[model samples]
Structure formats: structure tokens, C-alpha cells
Target: MTPESAALPGAMHPTDQSTQGCTANGEMILVVEDDVELLELLGTLLKSAGYQVAMAKDGMTALESVTRGGVQPDLILADFNLPGAINGLQMITQLRMALHRSMPAIILTGDISRLTSRDVAFEHCVQLNKPAKLKEVTFVIASLLAQQRNAKNDSERPGQFAPGIARSSIIFVVDRDDLFRHTIRGVLESHGYAVHDYATSEAFLADYAPGPPACLLIDAHLPGMEGVELLHQLRKNGDDLPAVVISGSNEVSIAVDAMKAGASDFIEKPFGRSEMLQSIARALEHSQDANKKLAWMQEATHCIDSLTLRQRQVMDMVLAGFASKHIAAQLGISQRTVENHRAAVMTRTHSKSIPALARVALAADLRV
Candidate 1:
């Protein structure tokens, strides 16, 4: 359908009362779908709500547009079933690599049963079934964009510094068995780890927030929303909290599913204290690595944001391995002038050498 024809009229429009509460403020959205009609409908809806929309018919086109720096979208809305080998999740991953940062995304699919925990494991990404209500879609988009804005603001706040070290050493245990919870809590507490035990997954999720160096010991079989599903939900919400799954039966399929759901490790029932401790140690180590990468990404983003337009151009050329003379010629300036801008770029980025400057640019995903 044509863009004009796809536009909803008056009361049926996105700007109507149903979606008025979640109006967009010029945030760019990249919509990818193989269906032309659906794609046009999404573009029109988003544009009507004040978002700048970019359309892609398939995953490859979306990747090419993002990597080529054609559009820097704030959020991506992609259909899971694409024509090519690249799916919605893979396209999001490629875009994240190009930007040198995680971007918010939502996967729209008709068959919710076909989706596995691994498909939506990306940070700041969620999946919605097809035929979703327009109000629901608008609310999710607004929430994700608002989260991004809040995170950026928090990073820029004064007196705020990235915590290179882990926070509190707390372990949360979620199991239906009272005896097991008591025994595990005692064992963990004896080993110098603070343990909080909950009777069900619901209780744990209600009290849980992302904080500190922590791990979750969840039973594989729970009354509702099994352990692996809980882990998947946490990961989808951008929570990097390490988790270990414990099951009564040593089923290989269960272990594999838990791992796919972002669990650090899986342990069979009747585990020893030493075994549990080892799993916790490994999970904490993984958390530390994630924290370090997050810090580096944040620092690189800040440094890149501090550069002026000319300085950014110079930095990009340097990263591209262009010599000062060639860069000056391309930019229509003298070689000495190029060197001056180059020096300023290095100083502002706090990069001592060409290689260091290149690393910063790469980490920030700046395209030349």
C-alpha cells in the first residue's frame, strides 16, 4: 500500500486517545519486514506519532543501511521471519557491532511458540507476538526509548563514576522446596556469601532489581514460570544477573535449554557445597567480564560525544588509516591544518598514539 493510503484517519490514527499517552518526540525507528503492507502500516503509525521512520524489506538491507551510516535509529522494530539467512536477532547483533553499543529492539512474530530463549537474549530487546494491539506496541516503544534516555542521562550526571568493581556479594535462591532453600542458604552463608531465599519464582522476580555481584540459584521445576523461562525474562529486560539452574533429574536437554536461556551453569540435584561454590565463582567471574566491557563502552561513547564536527572527521580519517596529507587533500585543507585537528582529536579523546585513537573510534563505532 502507498504511504498516504496507509495513513489511518482521524479517530483511528495513532495520534488518537489510545496512543496519545505515548507520543514519540522525533526518535528515529528502523522498521524491517518482508510484508510490504505491514511495513507501510508500521511506518505510517510511527510517523503519525512523531517518530522518524526508516523502512527495510529484509534483514540484509537493514544491516547495510545501519553499517553504511545511512541512518542512526534509536530503536529497531523487526519481524523475526526475514527472507534471507539473517533473522531479526542476527540483524540486531550486526547493528550493535557497527554502533559499538547495544541498541534497543523488538521482535514481532506470528508464531510465538517457535521462539526460544536464545532468540531474544540480546540486551534491551524483547519479543512481541504478531497482531499486537497498536497501543501495546506504542507503549513498549516509548518505554524502551525512555530507558535509553535515562541511561544516557545517568552516565552524564555529575559526581557519577562507573563502578569498575562489583557491588554487594549477594546470592538469591528460588526453589519450591523449603528444605532445599534452607540447606542452600545455610551452605552459602557459611561460605561468606549473603543468601536470600524465596519460595517461588514470582516472589523472587518481584523483589529482584539489578545490583551488585550476585547470582541466582533457581530450581528447574517451579509451580509457575519455570526457572529457564525466568532466566530468559530477566535477560530480555536487560538484566545481566548471572544465574545457575538446579534440576532434580540430570537431563541433558534441560541443561542445554538453561544455558541457551543465559544461565551461567546447571547443577543436578544432591549437589555438594563445593560444587555449588564452584558454580557461583564461575558466574561471578562472568559478571566481572561483562562489567568491564560495559565500562569501556560507556567511556568510548563519552569521548566520542565530546568531539567537535571537524575533530570527529579527523579522528575518523585517522581510524581509516589515512595519512595526514591524503586527509588534508580530501578535506580541502593544508597538511599542517590536518595535523592540528588530528592533535586536537587525540588530546580530546585522551589517546596517546594512532593505534590508541583507532581503538577508541572502533569502540565507539564511529564510521568514516
Candidate 2:
């Protein structure tokens, strides 16, 4: 439908009042959903909120209604996994093609893991998880319409930010149990963090990207890839992001493995909010300090290329809790040679002491 033809009168026609109740002239919302109960609930909510409502049971009908019936829906709320051949993303794409422009849309889904192209690119398009409260739905819809109206009035105005805004950070939440995703998201959102919850290692890996949250909270026992493996993957990939492991396990071996794999800290699950927050804060603080130390180490390394490879090896072992005798045995060098290399390394790097050199090595990504 052309823009002019799809624009309906301000109010619902008198004949439509009995089913939807009286509605004021608000934005027109077209809800295309296959679930009957969900559709009716959403329709009633929108109608009560002063919107001129339209409905379609599937993508084909919705497309037909718009292209042939001359119904120009101002905004669309659709399901990601829809019945029949056309899905929500395809429908929106087709609509944009037919209308020669993009229309605002929301994808409602039970599977939050399914992210479409529209969700990633368009700031106007939102994803609302299934079983959304009526008030929550109303708030999101109103917010979008307000944004559109504001843009119309002054295109230069900035868009609305979600409440409790903060800079983006890496958020690693691992829970084999499905419900924790919602709980963790709520907790983080309440504290002004934009949260991304992962159900499994596979999900996290698939969705993984650079520049994630400032912190990670991972469950110790994730499906397929355990927390240790996940941490190893991140470390191997050169992502030194701060991470906290949440585990129900009490085995010291598990904790040791996690630490060896580069986990900043570990905490037992069913932990109180205070414990969780403290762990996260500590990890972030350590990561920040580690980054600074690493920068210094890199500068030092550039100036210390004169040291032999064996001297650097001895330097790493000494700082990693090895005495001269053990360092000699490990590197197959004599104790005297290990001592000489250790002194040469410290001198070359200008490290004041063995402890300082060890810190530098850690920052420099030493393997031992």
C-alpha cells in the first residue's frame, strides 16, 4: 500500500468499537502473530492504549493486507518463528521492498537466542522476549512511537536511551539452568548494566564478539564446553577480559583448573547478591590493573631485545614461584647459569627486583 492509502482515520470506525473497546487516535500498530491467545491479548492492550489496531494471523496474510488491502501499518510487532513459509524477518524485508522504505518493527519470541539481521542493525527494531507483561509492552511501544514523533518534529534529536544506562562491557553468565538468564539480566539491568545472558558455551561462542562487557560471570558447569574450556578459548584468542566463575562444585581440582585456564576468580553458586557483586568488582579491578602492567611490560620488552632467549626463560620461571635450583632443573640449565640469566634479565628489563620482573612477565603474556 502507498503511504497515503494506508493512513487510516484518527479513530477506529464506530462499527469496530464493540470488540476492541473505545480507542483514541494514537499510532497505528499492526500485530502479525500466529498464536491466538497472544494475538488477542496484545490487540486488547494496544486498543486500550489508544492505538488503531490491525491483525494478521501469518506473514502471507499480513503482506496481502498491506500490499493489496491498502492498510499501511505504522509499526509492526511480529514473531520470529512463525508458521508457514514466510518468517518475521522475511516479512519485514518484503514489506520494505514493497513500500520502498523501512518500517519500525518489534520481534516477539520465546527463543531469545534467535537474532535476526534487523535486530543487529536497526536501532528502531526491538526484540521482546515472550510472556512480556502488559505494562512492559506498553512502555516499549510508547517509547518507540515517542521516538518516531520526536524524529518527525526534529530529526537532529538523539534517540531515547534505555533507563539505567552505562558503557557496554563483557558479560559472561553461564547457567545450564534456563531460568538464571532472566534473573541475571534483571540484576545487571537494575544496576545500570546492559546485559547479555548465555545459556550454554555454544550460545556464548556463537554470539561472541569483541568489545563485550567490562566483566564476565560464567557458570562453572556449562553444557558441552565447561567453564575452563571457555576461559581457555578466550585466553587463546587473546581476549584478556575479566571473568568470574560461578560454580556449584566444591572440588579444589575444578577451581585450580579454572585458575590455570585464566579465570580471575571463582565463586560457588546460590551465592548472595553481595558475594556475586564483590567477585565481579574484584575481577574487573584486577583486569584493569593487569592491562596497565601489560602496557608497561610491552614498552620494557621493546628496549630489552639484548637479552638471550634462555635468559628470558629463566626470568619467567624465577617469577613464577621457582627457586634457582628448581628453575635450573626445569630449564635443564645449571643453578649458576639460571642465576646469571635471572640477573641479566632483571638488568636488561630494568626491573628493580625478582618480584617486579615476575609481574612484568605476567603482563607480557608469559606462558609458564
Candidate 3:
């Protein structure tokens, strides 16, 4: 069906009005699984939720569907194990490479123990144990789409800063395949992390700007820069980004190399869901620490000259927890003027709130 024909009866065409949700007309989701019954069930559930759905029996077919644009699924739900050469993860690496755009994704599997520590570390991706929970699936799909919409908007408006742990956190998936990328993207977003996906090391390096990424999950066997090389490049560029490497290969040498190149950890493919989550948590924690240090360094580097005398006074007072009105009176200035100075302090310090500014001020050798 043409894009218009795919619209729900009596519903606005996805092409017409972009809705507030991640999907405008309806988000397109590609369901890839060897099991016919599960695929049908997933399709039905997604359609009921107002999503445009497509299906593929295996990894290669899923890639073809994405390539043909028969349905450019905004997300993919894939089975980890598949019939032939390309498994779910392999396919994910492929499709994502073909289409540089990031799509949210989730992996459905029977065994959670199959995944390794490294596979679980990828950000904005999730895996569901077999005999899936429908509610969990529903929530995952909705959450990922919402994150995608927010990420797209944030990327477009680079200067707008939002305050919150969610806003500061980001997940990056460096997989070559599209279906796998989608599956993982679905999983991570479901767990509540903003995700940015790229198919290849080249693509990721070229397009990914330094921002709010909390951690990176990368496939070891990428087209251009292997995970080790990519890890090195990121560090060389002064991006102390934490990463976890997942590989189908079980070579000790490879694992060692990945770690040496800066991967926080390594996992062999076909890993369990629980393992993936645990690994990701570890990497995120590491990334968070690194980011905090970086933020402090940057704040300290800002020139004293950037702030007006009034701004400095306001910042110190705010850090001390004085109310705006109180600061105004103490400074013998109008509350509005004090508020303006407070805003300037935040702008200059890149602080989200008065407390955040105060913490930065305390860390830095503030002139005031």
C-alpha cells in the first residue's frame, strides 16, 4: 500500500500531520522472527497501538524489507536466533549500516543467559526473555518511539538545554545491521535511556557529535573501523567515553585488544538479557563519572571575565541557597535585576539550576 493507503481508517495520514508522539501518521515497526505465530501476534499488537507494521521471517528478509522501503520501520522487533547465516544481532548490524538513521529496537529471546556481559552494555537497547510480556513489549515500543522523537528534536535545536538525569544521559549503538540496531534500540529506550544509533564506525564518527551520551555499546566486527579501532579513535579525540564491545568471535586475543583499545568490557555474542543490562549499568556508571569530571574541568576553564560583577555576586548567593528576593535585597538591587544576573550566571556556567551552578562554583576556583 502507498503511504497514504496505509493510514488507519478515519485517522490522519502519517505523512500529513506529525503527531506529538514519535510517530506522526503512525510509527512503522518491522517484526522479524522465524516463528510465524509470534510475528503475527506482535504485528497485531503493534497495529492495535496505531503503529504501521511489517514482517520478515528471517534476518536477510528483514534487511530486504527495510531496503525496499516496502516499510521503513521506525523500530524493529527481532528474534535473537534465526535460521541461516544472519542471526538477529547480525542482521541488526547490517540494516543499521545500510540506513544510517537510528531506529529504536528490541530483541526477543528464549534464554536470558545466552547473552554475555558485553552485549548487555549497549545503551538504549533491551532484550526480552522468551514467552514475552505483552505489556512490557507495548511499553518498550512506546518508550523508544518517544525517545526518538525527543532526540530528533534535541538534535535539531542544539542550543536548548533541559535539566534532568534523562536529558543528560545518552546511549549509542554502533552496530552494522539495521534490524539488530532496531531491536536493541527498543530494549534500551524501554529501560529509559535516550539512544543514538549508527551503523558503522565511519558513520558514527562522522555524524555523532559530542553531547549527552552516557555510554556506548559497539559491535566488534564493523565494516570500517573495528570496535578496537573505534574505541581508540574516540579516546584519541579526548572523548573519554565508556564503551562495551560485543563480538560473535570468541578469541581471547580479540577481547584483550578491545579492552586495550578502551572498551570497558567485552562480551561474546548470543548473550543473555540480564547480562546485557548489568553490563550497560556498569558502563553508564563509568561514563557518568567521566562526564562529571569533564563538566567540572570545563566549568573551571571558563574565564572570570565572562561574568559581570553582579552575576558573580548572584551566583555565590544562589549557591549559598539565598532566595532571589533575598539576594536582591542583600545586593541592594531589584529582584528582577537579581533574577537577570542569576540567569546570566547560569548561562555563563552552563549550569542547569542554582544548585548545579553552586556545585560547579564550589569545585572551581570562583573569583567571588
Model 2, stretches more than 4 Å misplaced?
Answer: 1-25, 114-124, 153-368
Clashes in predicted model 2: 7
* Candidate 1 vs. true structure, TM-score: 0.42
- Compute the lDDT of residue 57 as modeled in candidate 3: 96
- What does candidate 3's lDDT look like per residue over 1-368, in tens digits? 53223432321123333233444348888888887766776677678778888999999889888788555778888888888788786677567556744466787766566342235334234776666555556666787788777674522121222223434668789998786788778656645668889999998888777766577889999997888889898988898787888888865456556665766667766664444555666566546667855664565557334787778777767655578899988999999999888777777777653333533454464532
Instruction: Give, for candidate 1, the lowest lDDT window spanning 10 residues.
Output: 155-164
Work out the TM-score per prediction. Answer: 0.42, 0.36, 0.42
Best by lDDT: 1
Estimate every model's Cα lDDT from 0 to 1: 0.72, 0.64, 0.67
- How far does residue 195 in candidate 3 sit from its true spot (Å)? 24
| Model 1, span 198-294: residue lDDT tens | 9888999989887767889899899988999999999899997888888877554576567667776777655544456666766776577777656
Per-residue lDDT tens digits of candidate 2, residues 136-189?
555666766666665654221111122212344446676776656765665455
